[model samples]
Structure formats: C-alpha cells, structure tokens
Target: MSIYRKDIYVFDGDRPVKALIRSYTEADFEGLIRIQQESFPPPFSPELWWNEEQLGNHVRLFPEGALCVEIEGELAASMTGMLVNYNPGDPDHSWVEMTDAGYICNHLADGNTLYVVDIGARPAYRKLGLGKWLMLSMYEVVVRLNLQRLLGGGRLPGYDRVADEMSAQDYVQAVIEGKLKDPVLTFLLRCGRTPVRLMADYLDDEESHNYAMLMEWRNPFLPQES
Candidate 1:
C-alpha cells in the first residue's frame, strides 16, 4: 500500500504537464471521440462515443463523482465513473455490447460492480503523467461516492497470450524492453486494480482480436496527501 501511495503524486519527470479535472459536457462529446479515435483501434463512432460519454456523465448524478481533464487547452483525458450497485434503474448504469461482451457476461454473470468504462489520453501528450493524473482523479471520485471498488475491462489487444506472430510478440517484447507504455494497466495497478484476462481465445478471430481484462480496485481511495 505504501509503495502505491507514492505513485499518486507526480514523479520527478519533465513534460510540462498541467491537468484540470471536471465533468463531461455536451460540448465535450465530439472532442472525447477525437481523443478515443487517436488512442485505440476500432475506435468508437461519434454516436457510440456520444452514448458512452453520456454514460460517463452519470458519475456526477450519483454520490460517486466523475471527471474529465483538459491539458493545455486540449481535451486530454477522461475518467468515467462506475456504479457500485449497477442496477440499470439505479441512478446511472451501463452495459455495453463489445466484441467480448458475451464472454465477459457469461464469465462474471452475476454481480454489482462499478467500472471505469472509458479512459484514454491524447497521443502526442502521452507518456507524461497526465494519464495517471486522470486515473487518480477517477480514484478520488470513487472514494467520494464511498464506493468500495471499481471494475472494468482493460487492454484487450488482438494477441493477448500467444505472441507467436513476430509483430505481436515483438510488441509484447517491446513492453518487456521498456519501449512501450502500458499506461492503462500500469495505472490500474497503481490504483491497486486487479485485472483478469477474459476471453483469451477471441484473439484467434482477427476482427474480434479483442482481448479484455478485468481490473478490480478493492480499496478505491487515494493515499492521503501529506
């Protein structure tokens, strides 16, 4: 726990980073789509991002808080709030149809869990701590709602386990060699999120090369600021 407490503050790095965390707005939807399109594959359509953006907005309606961050006047990042008791009728809740939806649904069929559904940082400004800042912002929001934990599916690329393909294995090796930034998973760990890879076989289908990992945060509070 103490090891992770230190992870919350800005490290001694140089990137001219300044983050402002706040709620999602109607005006911010398109910008959010732009950010998502830049960071991941099979990116969300404007309509999809718009719907997900609205879902993220639900964090504010609950005792739980949600936030988006603007860095240097650009919509740099967003942290969607999760519902602790996720009954659709309960405040604001969401269930998505993803490539792995069926697998994840059957895998963890019964439960009430809050998840950080959408998290992405702009490409150019990535590797800076801005992403972590956004994550900690979400962490604070979870605690404010007095929620015990958060849940979500994280980095599910086409090749999760089998790195037989040179390109795919190279990518994994790059991560081992410190050449790639596993920002999302790293942030999940720093927040003490435990992730389980679900639907590992989906990688066989190139189109559905989607790999999903479940990230759980048992204690959703940030380390006290000294």
Candidate 2:
C-alpha cells in the first residue's frame, strides 16, 4: 500500500539526477547503515543507532512507511516511520519510547498518527532538497492512509552554541520566529511543522544536550466531520 514509487527526480547541481524514492528492501541494508553512520557521527552514539536487524523489522512491519531515496542506483537518503495512536493531551514521549530505542516496536497499524522514527541524508547529498522530498513523500503516505498527524523529535543542532544563554523552549521559539536558524528545527518549521514542546533526555545526542523539540504536522487532508 505504498503511495510512492521510484519515479521521483531531483536535480544535482544542474545534472538532472534521476532519483528513486521508494520503500526499503533487504538490499538497502548496507547503504542504510553507511548513511546513518556518516550522517550522524560522534554525537549520535552507537547505542542510539539503528542496525540491520531493526531496520529490516521496520520494512517487514510497515513497508509502506519505510522510504529510501536512490540517486543513480546509490542510496542517498532514507526515512523510517510508523503509524501510532498518539494522544495529543498526553505528555511528550521520549525518542527511546517512540522508536523503541531504535528497535521500532511501537508501530501500530491502525494508529491515527504517523510517527517519523528517523530520517537522514548522506553527507555528500546534503542540501539537495532530498530531506524535504522524503518528508513530502511521507506526507503523501499520511494523506493516503488518512492519518491525523505526523510526529517526530526535531533535533536542535544549533542549541549547544546558545544553550548557555537561553532555555530549550526559548531557543525553539527563537527559531520559529526566524531570530535563530537551527539546522534541524528550523528546517522542520519551514516544512510546516510546529514545535509542541521541548523534550529533555529525548535521545543520547550530546549536540542537542539530549534534548529534542516535539514536533507535529497535522494533516490538512483529513476528512471533515459530518
């Protein structure tokens, strides 16, 4: 029930690269591992990383939600997500719980929210709009499944530089107001996602101070009530 195929294309420096945005396959294991390692280095610990077995389970559990981008048959970026019944009124959940510490055991087929587990673009392919395209691809999945919203932890890569001067909440607010340009949070905000709250100990990343911005993008295509 995948809404996206491998027909998408994005230009790589005016070269007109033919990119394939599609579901994850066993053959992509090595590529995914390499991308994760390269995209998120030291700050992202080995304990917080996803392995071949965990990623394979995601494909088996929710093939439609697992997406990968290939440029000229080389894996460029990948996004992993799952459907979950999220209660907006409830407190923000930690990354460990949402992604099951990268095991992805929280996926629920009949859930109303699409929880984005992880999304990363290889260092070489950065700024090619691959991340945005992958997100839009997931948005398509949301519309196709009639999900309520898309949820994930938005990393604050620019926080460490300013943490001594303000709180995480204040940093997020500044980013939203365009006063600050956080590498991750700012991009998510630009993509129409809203910061719900600042989550402490969300992950093991020292760059983010183990903090993450709980973000959500409500689906505009949800059916109206009668």
Candidate 3:
C-alpha cells in the first residue's frame, strides 16, 4: 500500500509552489541528505546528518515509515519513523538511545507506538505547511497500523534564550501556557501533540541547551485500559 500522497503548496518565494507528498524510495537518498544539509547547516555537525547507510536501513527496515514531500522532482521535506513498544513509566530517553543513532535498529514490528526519528524541510520550505502535512501523514500510519500513538522527542530550540532565567520545566510550561514560542516545540504543539515532560541532554543543540520535550499524539481509537 502507498504510504501517503497529496497535493500541497510550499510558500518559497513570490508564489506558492506545488508539491507532492509520498513515500520516499532508495533513489531519494542523496536528496534526503541534501534536505538535511539545508535544514541544518554548518555549526550543526555534518557527521550528524543522515548517511547512506542509515537511509538504506530505513528503507530496508521500514519503508512505509519514511515519507517525503517533493517539488517538481525535487525532494523538499521528509519525516522518518519506526514502531516501538514504548514504556510510559520511563519517559526519559535521549535521541541517540531511541533512534539508535538514526539507524532505528530497535524498531519493533508489533510495537504499539510509532516513534519519530526526524522531521524537517529545506530552509526555504520552513514555516510552511509541509512539516505539518508530513506529521499528519505519519499520524495516518498510526491509524492504519492500529498503533497506540505517535511519540517523539522534540527540540526546545528557543530555550537557550531563557535558560539562565528559568528551569527547563518552567520553560516548557511557558510554551504550554502560550506565554512563549519555540521554533520546534511550538510547531509540534500546533500539530496536536501533548507535552509529556521535559527531557535533559536529549540532543546536542546549543539553542535548546541540549533539552527536549517528550511529546505524544494518542490514537483516538485506542481502547481504554481495562
């Protein structure tokens, strides 16, 4: 079955550019890396970007979990994920631990949670609806697979500005209260994910002070625990 497909618009320059959302393939590996490069430029370690081996693993392990948006044959955005038996009791986890350093080696086929490894768009495509569409597409996967929820560690990219003034918990509370806006966290919130808790050393992002927020979007159809 096809992962997802839809017509979308990317507000790049003077006009809205037409785009298509669909499951990515092995052929798009280089394009995906380019998207990451543009999304996270220099100062963001190049070694952290998706490599050929990781992309190969993603396609081989869970092809349906890899989705991307393309503009006239150009890959503009992507979101990669895999299933896992999530443990709610232990919510604290680093990106490296969960994602297996982006290779997603721990993916469990029968797991109830679809854990997102990464989601990003090219610089020019940022703030557009592309990211949201990519997220929604993954949510669709949760429904199709009859999973419990979608989970991920989202960066608090705007936290550093107030790091010395308040605690990470306080900062997350501010975002939840709508008193502040974070580049990454705010976007995830807007996409319907509920904040779980603030996680420390989640990533190496200086802007986030290496903090992240564990977020989740529950499957509405999941049966209540009996």
Candidate 4:
C-alpha cells in the first residue's frame, strides 16, 4: 500500500536532498502531526489538524492515496486524498464537508474523481518544489485508479494583502494572469490546475478571507467523452 519513488529530490539552498515519497504507516503519525503544525500556523483550528483516528481512517479507506515524504530519515511532507463522484457543472461540497472538517468523511471507491483532501510540507522544505512533487504524485494515483481528474480547493494566502483593493474573484484572476502572486493558488496554477470558481467559507483561515479557489486538474491521458 506504499509507493516508493527514488528519483525525487529537493534542494535546500545549494544542497541537493533526496526525498522518499511513500504511503503512510502507523509509525509516521507523530511526524505527520509535526509537519502539519509547522506548515499551517495558527488560525487553523485545532480540530483541523490530523489525528491518529483520522489518519487511520484515510489509510483504511484509500491507502494508495495517502502518501508521505521523508528527507534524510525525517518525515518532511504528506498528502491525503479520497475518491468521489460529482457533476462537473456543480460541486456541492466545501473543503470542510469534503474532508470531514479536515478528517476525511466519506470516500467513494467507485467514484471517478480523486479529491485532494490535504497536503503540506515542512517549513524548511518550502520553495523546494516538494509540494509540486507531491501534487504530481497524486496524479499518478489518479491514473492508477483510472479516475477522471483531480479536484481540490487552494487557499488564497495573498488575499489579505489586497482584499480592500479587489474582490476574491479579481484576486484569483490577477494570479492567473501573473499580475499577483498567491503562495498557494499561483503554484497550483503553474502545476496545470485550473481555478473553477471561488468558494466562500471554505475553511477557517482568515488570511484567505474565509475563501478558497476551487480547482481541477484533468488527466490528460484519460479518454474524453463527447
């Protein structure tokens, strides 16, 4: 129930560090918590962080979709997701409902869409392409599961800097057009994910103005239906 990728590496300044991306194990519980806390600071409620039960449920529901990364024998990053089915025209769930308030509620195995519930990297590992690596790794899961696409909500961390100057949609459009840089959504866009719409009250982060960008990344290899 683990995927081992040997070729992935991220650089800390000029030092090249190899990272092992694999499925979660019972032993990784503490490491996951530490990294989660480091990646997401305060303002995210305590209930939003991963606990043993929630992590265990994710492993039980979809082991292949639950993955972690290790660098120099230390757990540095992780990504969790679940299978779901929804109409492309209207997605009914927000980040809270889809992830069971960040714990992942119901995972539909027969569903064609792979929902990225959560993902984070250690502070020291930021800007090293680790997040992008993990995201691309999720795409591998989608292909292996024969899913239609990958979907998730991206936090607008840069919103607070210019909220009074523009609307959320305007901010998103600015990011897409390269007029502004959102630490989260811009990177997602660079990774080939498209912003579908703005989601209100998606999470508790005040930095994003309690908003998020609903995004999607289709599997290019999958056949399209007319």
> Which candidate leads the pack in TM-score?
2
lDDT of 1 by residue, 13-45 (tens): 653455566666656767776776776545333
Candidate 3, 70-183: lDDT as tens digits: 888888899999988986887588999998999988889889899999998998767567899899989989998999999999988788889899999999999889999998
lDDT head-to-head 3 vs 4, winner: 3
Worst lDDT run of 10 residues, candidate 1, spans: 1-10
Using TM-score as the yardstick, the better of models 2 and 3 is: 2
lDDT of 3 at 11: 76
Cα lDDT listed for each candidate:
0.50, 0.85, 0.87, 0.85
Give per-residue lDDT, candidate 2, residue 186: 80
TM-score of each: 0.61, 0.94, 0.93, 0.94
Whole-model lDDT, model 1 = 0.50
Worst 10 residues of 2 by lDDT: 217-226
Rate residue 144 of model 2 by lDDT. 83
Mind giving the per-residue lDDT tens digits that candidate 2 earns over 79-172? 9998888887777778888877777777888999899999999989976789988998898888888899899999888899999999888888
Residue 104 CA displacement from its true place in model 4, Å: 2.5
Per-residue lDDT of model 4, residues 14-51, tens digit only: 88878888888878999999988998887766667888
Model 4: ten consecutive residues of lowest lDDT: 1-10
CA lDDT of 100 in candidate 2? 77
Better of 2 and 4 by TM-score: 2
User: Which residue pairs does candidate 2 place in steric collision?
Assistant: none
